[model samples]
Target: MYFCLFPTWHSKVFRNDVIFIYDKYFFNLWFDLYLKYFFLTSELIILISSLWV
Candidate 1:
């Protein structure tokens, strides 16, 4: 089951405690994807900026 890793950021009244149990799998998956394309995106930005300059 998926739940918000950070509960405090959301409204307390809508928290729904039963589903808020901590799990790291989703975070790990997301982070892996972020890291996978992080450099590609950064490089693309740099390349675009250099062309504009």
Candidate 2:
């Protein structure tokens, strides 16, 4: 048999928890992507600038 400790509030609590977890994961993923692109762009600019000088 299955049992729910908080039958009435369990669904809402579970949904909120899932959303919170997903938001954290997504935030980290996007932040890493942004940093990766920023570094790449900076490297390209430095290389181009050096070529001119």
RMSD for all candidates, in order, please. 6.0, 11.7
> What is candidate 2's CA lDDT for residue 28?
66
Model 1, position 6, has a per-residue lDDT of 46
Model 2, span 1-53: residue lDDT tens: 11122233433456777765665666667678889999999999999999999
Question: What are the Cα lDDT values of the candidates?
Answer: 0.60, 0.66
> What would you estimate as the lDDT of candidate 2?
0.66
TM-score, one value per model:
0.45, 0.69
**Top lDDT: which candidate number?**
2
Candidate 1 local accuracy as lDDT? 0.60
Q: 1-53, model 1: which lDDT tens digit per residue?
A: 22445433333445755433322444566677878799889999999999999
Q: Stretches of candidate 2 above 4 Å error?
A: 1-15
Task: State the TM-score for model 1.
Answer: 0.45
